[model samples]
Target: MLCGCVGLVWLYEGDVEVAVYLIWLALVFDFLDGFVARLLRVHSPMGKELDSLADLITFGVLPSFILYKMLQQQEVDAWVPYLAFLVAVFSAIRLAKFNIDENQQTVFIGLPTPANAIFISSLIFVDGSYPSLLSYPVLLIITILFSYLLVSPMELFALKFKDFGWKGNEVRFSFILFSALSLLFFLHLALPMIVMMYILLSFFVKIISTT
Candidate 1:
């Protein structure tokens, strides 16, 4: 809740970097809330529902707000703002599916809400350096692509810790290692690239495992 408020302030201030960091902070809180819940053996149906609702606000609504800000700056067509709502709707669907799906106990069936949020936030975070890339047409296409990923069937996103010593976990471990290195080197600017890479890497891993 505090993180969400901070993000809202950053949004109003037009500080995309701070807003992105606040989104990341929300992600940390999201993780800790679940961790503490489990450690305290206080997990309940209401807690689960509450977490999802919090996520909807932090990840879904906040990202859309950031994207809307970006589009406003670009003087994008008035209709472009509607695409931001697509993210929120798709995120709601993703969270609802996660709640009911037995297969998502250990892994996600589609892109997670936090990832989607980070992806959108990163676009604003690096907007100046990637001016040509952040144009309305490109952003529109990306918005559509990410919305598709939110419900994409072939994606198998992981939510649990991979066993470090396990043979089959090598890809997961390597991906995490590379992601950490990317963050270390590029800070927030690397977020979107690393996330896209992770999605592609997961696809190949799934293909190999299935074979």
Candidate 2:
């Protein structure tokens, strides 16, 4: 609760970098809650429900707030900020569906909330490094494209360690390695490029796996 409140305050103050760090802290709490539950064998129905609610606020609401801040800096019309909220709406649906979807026990069928949060946070960081790219038209287009990715059916994203080793892991591992190098070399400027690589690589892997 403290982390969530701090994150909301950061968002309200337009301190996106601080908000991103707070969201990472929220993720840490999320990890510990599950770990503690399993460690003590105290997994109750209430715990599950509370975790979901916490996730909605930490991952869904906070990231949307950052996007809203980015859109506010744009010179576009009013509808642009509203459109950014779609990321939040889709995130909620994704989380709810994850809770009910049996197949996702092994792997995610869509973008996971943390990954979405990281992607959004990376954009905020990137904007500081590349202000010229955050024009109203470009930000609008990016919002629409990412919002589509949030709900896109054909995208097969990897969310597990197995998807990173041996046979078919070659491309995925290479992509991650290259992405790491890019980040080390270019810092936040590599964010969107790396994310694009992830999406495209995942799409190609899915295609090859199917055929």
Return the top candidate by TM-score: 1
lDDT of 1 by residue, 1-211 (tens): 5676778888888777787788898989888987787679888788888888888888988888887777777776787777778888888998888888888766678899998888998886578677877888887887788888988886665746645575766667787888899999998788998889878987987898789
For candidate 2, what is the lDDT? Answer: 0.74
Q: Which ten residues in a row have the lowest lDDT in candidate 2?
A: 156-165
lDDT by residue (tens digit), candidate 2, 16-43: 7898888878878877776687679888
Which sections of candidate 2 miss by over 4 Å? 28-47, 155-157, 162-172
Worst 10-residue lDDT window for candidate 1 reads 155-164
lDDT of each: 0.81, 0.74
Candidate 1 contains a number of clashing pairs equal to: 0
Task: Point out where model 1 deviates above 4 Å.
Answer: none
Per-prediction CA RMSD (Å): 1.8, 3.0
Quote the positional error of residue 92 for candidate 2 in Å: 0.9
